[model samples]
Target: MVRRANPAIQALKEETYIMSAVFDHGEFDHHEQIVFANDHQTGLKAIIGVHNSFLGPAAGGVRMAPYARMEDALTDVLRLSRGMSYKNALAGLPLGGGKTVLIGNPRTDKTPALMAALGRAIERLNGRYLAAEDVGMTLADMEQIATETSHVFGRDPKAGFGGEPSPMTALGVALSIRTCVRRVLGRDDLKGVRIGVQGAGAVGADLARQLGEAGAEVLVADVDPARAQAAASAAGGQVVGVGDILFADVDVLAPCALGAVLNDETIPALRTKIVCGAANNQLAEPRHGLALAQRGILYGPDYVVNAGGIINVAYEVSGTYDAAKVVEHVQRIPRTLEQIFEEAADEGLTPDVIADRMAQRLIGRS
Candidate 1:
């Protein structure tokens, strides 16, 4: 007999319908559900969002964080899964959306056994949902999970053996940023343009390096002082406090950190003309894109700019991984951004709307 639906999963299904009325195209099959488990000993709680399989399988990352409540984790998984859908669609990948979140701090709660158990739980999905690295996941952790299951990505050669996706992501973001700069600043080059990059993570550091190489004055900030210093030193950029990054006097603000950094609180303080980055779910809500446009900030949709890693992983999952193909896919960001910007301008619609329309077209074609 089939099991009864979990209350959390039922609530998520209801919430998705509510969100669809507002955002649209967030359809999910009945087979999709949020799986959860509580490990009192390891103090690990997780919610896995297995959203769709229309393209192939549902693929996304497993993030571990200290969520205040299970509802927070559930909401994040649903939203992130939806983003993954658009991300894969825009990148022309044959995969749907799914994401998993572990409720606990990664630094203290992440253990080998915990990851192994998570992998086992992933294995229970029977290849319908594939998990990989994300905000709180690392290559080593992925390696440990690989021991429990073979359904994970991130080990693809195209990922440079789990190296930073930042460069490729940066390449995409930089290309779009350069395009935005050209349209706004009337210059095709990024030389002498001041850029403030938030979060000195793998992606952020690589972005800073690329900006510096392009002769853009790069400034960086991160919560981790060591990482901030390292990125700053490597890129010959100045380091600033994490909270001070949004207020920097730069041509662009690259939020390479967590999502929802573009909410009302930070948006009013933003002094940049252009916003582009490798971060996912940059907007707290769909309406926030409109807010950014009203503020005259050229916001590059996070999924559009940060699809490099997914593109790389898709190539791997398809058994035809090629570095050149990956680069070609990454390079498409500028063209996509340009098209979205043009459409948004021509129709006087928000960028998020344009992106969703484009993604919906792809889904319909499929």
Candidate 2:
């Protein structure tokens, strides 16, 4: 099937009633492709956004969410895919960025057939886009999709494939938080440094535990009470309510949950001296990063700070996979982040904008 590009599509952007109109608004200009996939038999309705592939074929994740509306899913994928492009650029990976989002209640609608349908949709992209597990997706789900197409990542380790990247991602985030502390807090140790974590999922839990073990005062909260309790227990920290996590007065605030948590309202409420997290798109918009900078808060660029997961997968994208090499690559994230911080300070630009410049330079796009 071929898509007809129409000049009139630009006018439709003003009509927010339609979701596809979002593409013509400016997203189409930033992205290389936006594909809507549907399979009636499997009931798979998904979208894949390939932001840029200047370095190589786009690589990101396949996410499934019970979004309230198709517009929500579209907004998420568009933002996430663009974030991946920056993530790759900052991580020094030779790959580009892309992401797939499946809209449905994962609890009931995600069947093996749906995974296969999503995989088939990816196959249609030929090798231009690769998929991995993200947010609501799992490694097992990626394996199921792998049955339909070879364009996937995060397979089981038993098959000599890369498994979940949460561990290394946690390591990278911890190191980044430390860098923030040293730069802004004027400290080299996290011991006795108060920290608040907003999310207790895989990466967040691991980050909390690591921080706790390092003698930091860690506080955590999650929408799921059980998860929050577990993470707090593992980290030897206290559990707070979801609403209180943002306003908690701490040296560093780590947001590990959803994107756009740093919008206008929350930025004003932030009491932390440094904002560093494992979440992507932490800023609701680019301006929010500048807002944080203007407030004298050190804001670690989300993509630059959280490149461990992508770095772990980038190893598999090239020649033979090496665990040691992947660990080395992920560990090097602190240096990359340090460079971003130094450059941002010297250039007097927000880390977000500076990191974007860094990425574009590497891919010859700057």
Candidate 3:
């Protein structure tokens, strides 16, 4: 029997209303799928959100986390899938938004057999949904899924054309940071800016390296102490604890960690002048972006800045992966950020609202 959702989960589900505006304007039908594994040892639960198929097949990432309730997973999948839809539209990919959330901790619950079972579940969905790496997932996990299914991304080393999306994503964030510095701090270069990066994963580490190369002081933190130390040492920066990153006294707080870090509680405590990174769904709610603006923080929209990965993946899936094309798209992030910020300032709205408007305009929904 499907369990009922508690109040907190219900509230998360309701948050999808903000995304509903774009979907309603586009007039796309949305589909939801839920899966439960019968394995006694590994009780895995998942929810897949297919927000639209107006363009082509639905594509997004599979996020795995230990949620306290099933409703939490459902809310995340729904919101993230909707974001993917907008992301595809803005990136000019012939794909719609879709996302899947495996309701368990990746640390202890993920197994080969369980992954295979999840692959079977994906196979059942057929071509309607394609999976890729997201929070709590890796390329190795995608490789495992490819053994059972073919509709996967991030497998083609050839598709990268000698450079993967991770670096491109970092580059996008770096460029946005530069733009933020110039606009918010009146500096044209990141020669000596101090940045506190909250995740030393692919995107965070890459951003840290880029910042260091550009002569920016970077402070890094990660749940894995070793990874944090390695990134900090390599970048010629200092390592801080994961919890201390949010309150770090730096010019920028780059959150490459999981989504929804900028909630009501964290928003009030942020100490950085700029908040920009490659993570998706950074805001716990739309109001958080407004709060950042109110606090004089230059906030870059997550979807706009993090679109480089999807742009690269789109080129790969289309069999026309070109480094120049990926670079062209990734480089546009700063311009997009500038436009969004300018529009937000002019219209007295949040960056996210302006970004959504731009995405809708690009997708022909506005």
Candidate with best lDDT: 2
Which residue pairs come into collision in candidate 1?
none
Runs in model 3 deviating more than 4 A are 1-44, 156-164, 361-366
Best by TM-score: 2
User: Candidate 2, residue 357: CA error in Å?
Assistant: 1.3
**Model 1 Cα shift for residue 89 (angstroms):** 0.2
Instruction: Report lDDT (CA) for all predictions.
Output: 0.81, 0.86, 0.80
The stretch of ten residues in a row with the least summed lDDT in candidate 3 is: 25-34
Model 3 lDDT vs. the true structure? 0.80
lDDT for each residue of candidate 1 in 144-178, tens digit (9 for 90 to 100): 88788988877634444533344567678778789
**RMSD for each of the candidates:** 5.3, 4.5, 6.2
TM-score of each: 0.88, 0.93, 0.85
Q: Candidate 2: lDDT over CA atoms? A: 0.86
- Model 3: lDDT of residue 308: 79
Clashing pairs in 3: 85-97
Once fitted onto the true fold, the runs of candidate 2 whose alpha carbons sit more than 4 angstroms away are 1-22, 26-29
